[model samples]
Target chain A: MSEVQRVENRELQPERAANQAAEQGWRDRAIVPPVDIFEQDDAVTILADMPGVTPESLGVEVKDHTLSIEGEIAVQMPEGVSARYADLRGSRYARYFTLGDEIDTDGIEGTIHHGVLNVRLPKRDTHRKRRIEIQAT
Target chain B: MFRDLWRANDPLFGDLGRLLRMMDSNWDNVGSADLRSAPRGSFPLLNVGETDEAYNVYVFAPGVEEQDIEISVQDNVLMLSGKRADPADDEKAAGRNWYRRERFSGEFNRAITLPDGVDADRVKASLKNGVLTISLHKRAEIQPRRIDIQAA
Candidate 1:
């Protein structure tokens, strides 16, 4: 009874991203990070790849049935070293999902390990199959 | 020439850069008749740079454990080989229903050629947030020498 869908927006799209530019927008500009979505009997798990992103830089929000994931990748250079080449594509990453009522937003949990972000969304009790008992005559 | 063609489609170099990087990667050395013709796609994309004393390489390989990876430089070619085990393919996810599977998982191999002056034995590697960075020190004899000029 529940479903999760990506919230498509222009900011994540390259050609349409210019409108979202700000003073610090060059580093804030984001591209849609690819994800793997799986559903289990009790909950749905979403895994996103955002390398170079620490837990402190990651953001996960749920509001009005919408879920958003955003983060930035900062290349750390040693004190004497200067950055000369960059091919990580971009520094920012973002993705969004629309949640159905069956999802228990309050019980959601998010964790990041080695730059892989895991978001678990549990299902509501009403959405689970209930076991019925037989009446004794 | 091809660069001009790619830029024509999207001036911002959105997806085109990824495509070009895939084609431009030096991922050859697969066992084949021609070692230079290895297949190219998206897997572990990387970046490279150099400091005055050493050369640096950054590998973007997310969702991987350090124990699963092996790094070495043989014959002046830096090689990185590793296995990325996502549960989707294993017995753990056998009965689970998958709505979408976009992230990649499995074994990966990457190799980049290094200049002759590097000290292969002095290479240093570290992993943080799924990105593995490696630095190869330059041989002392080949380092750039500065002649101090005394002001008269």
Candidate 2:
């Protein structure tokens, strides 16, 4: 009986917690778009899925050493057209982060194709860890 | 009548339509250069297919469940819509420094126009393992047939 009660409590706890979190607007529930990140040896690559967001509808800004990506995708139906189904809506896409001292923002590059965005951030060669050799005197 | 059914039965599709409308209504607000400048457009890749009978498009939308997909066809036009809800939206929203964002959150919608004679009524759609598959049937009038050549 105790075990069952404990399990029940565990299940209810999440709901209660979720309710509380919802009130704060800080729940893991996303009200924003989606994004993916990858790390490379000398740089990091970011890929975000922004369907309907054409190359002309996005914006990236950097300030105070912090990078922010913002944009909007506006899809136009064909002439004399009406939609029967759709999955995307127009909304703001945004993300921001502070860069570490080791990063070289000057070398950063990005590209957008078919609604997919890619950004490359390279790290400074001096900041990269390397092995040193020593010879006996 | 149809709109009512759609709204009650398929909120995802409804949301997709909303997105399309928003984009269309705000065309002047969008710019290719601006969109390219942002990180929101980044994605790995997508898959598409076309056959004599119909065209099939599949998107790798991980974390998207079957019920999340919404597909519809009207007047030989097909639309595919779905959302990969943000994993970090509901709880623990703050205090997490987002070093980078590549996954799409909120809502997503995709639309394609079908060729003449594509059977919108017989169209079928399915979702499996985060992949959304849409099959547009070809109308009988459009299907290629071997007509017998009559001798003059």
Candidate 3:
């Protein structure tokens, strides 16, 4: 009897569907978008695939050196459009990254290209490789 | 190496990253760019919906060029195939080192069966803003009614 009760209790936990709001009162499900991060001589660029997201719905925030990116996909059914079915649903793409001290947070720049979000973080002056010139004595 | 630095930064980082990776792997059917070449997991998830007039299909294919996409219909099957270019190509042209990669690139093909009555010949497709929308119209005329040998 105790075993069954424990199992039932675990089921009642806050865990819920990915597309449903259980923990937070968010409207849509939050998904982690795929990303590509590369380091260059001057900056580090992060590219994320965020489909169905419009320019007005995308958000990028940096606080305490932790970069957060989120894009909410808006779904508005036009007249005569109904009986929807299939995998694509209304959801939000959210992802977070911890920035290292070498990154110059103030110098960050971002843009969206065909639903792909590209964010470039410039490196600090002290961290960038400096080409030392040889002195001929 | 990149994971180690992130793990050392915060204790919650490990669990958070693990959970996010798990989700991304499971829901990779749409907007995913998995690197593995063998499995070729589902990429650019699609949605086929219906209305009174026709059926509409929406495919999420970010970063894919229009010229790279090919669409065809045969035997009531709609085939969507395309290649999403790798953004790292630009990085490589310039001297750069990769720290992490998760975005999907390369070729992917997906096929969805149409209803029995759809007129495959009347299908129309268009690509805009990385999203491909295809409209398949239903047969306009009803099937000819069968008559007995003693037709009046």
Work out the TM-score per prediction. Answer: 0.73, 0.42, 0.69
Candidate numbers sorted by lDDT from highest down = 1, 3, 2
Write down the lDDT that model 2 would get: 0.54
Residue lDDT tens for model 2, A1-137: 69999999999999767655543342122225566765655776666655445557777666788877766645432233232332332244667767788778888877765555667778899886566778789
TM-score of B-chain for each predicted structure, in order = 0.69, 0.60, 0.62
Q: Mark the regions of model 3 whose C-alpha exceeds 4 Å error after superposition.
A: A1-27, A75-77, A80-85, A131-137, B1-41, B141-152
Best by the DockQ measure: 3
Could you give the interface RMSD of candidate 2 in angstroms? Answer: 11.1
Give me the candidate number with maximum TM-score: 1
Q: Assess candidate 1 and give its TM-score to the true structure.
A: 0.73
Query: Which lDDT values do the candidates have, in the order given?
Result: 0.73, 0.54, 0.69
Q: Which model is ahead, 2 or 3, in terms of TM-score? A: 3
- Candidate 2 ranges beyond 4 A from true positions: A1-31, A79-87, A132-137, B1-5, B8-118, B121-152
Q: Could you give candidate 1's per-residue lDDT for residues A1-137 as a string of tens digits? A: 22322334433575345433431353345867779998877889899988888988889999999999998886686665544334454678999999999999999999989878999999998896566899999
Residues A83-114 of candidate 3: C-alpha lDDT, one tens digit per residue: 34344434788899999999999888988877
CA lDDT, candidate 3, residue B134: 89
Best by lDDT: 1
Compared with the true structure, what per-residue lDDT tens digits does model 3 show for residues B1-152? 11211221222223243453455467445554423211222578665566665777788888887899999887556778888887666546467688778878888887666566678888887765556788887776632356679868
lDDT of 3 at A40: 80
Question: Positional deviation of A130 in candidate 1, in angstroms?
Answer: 5.8
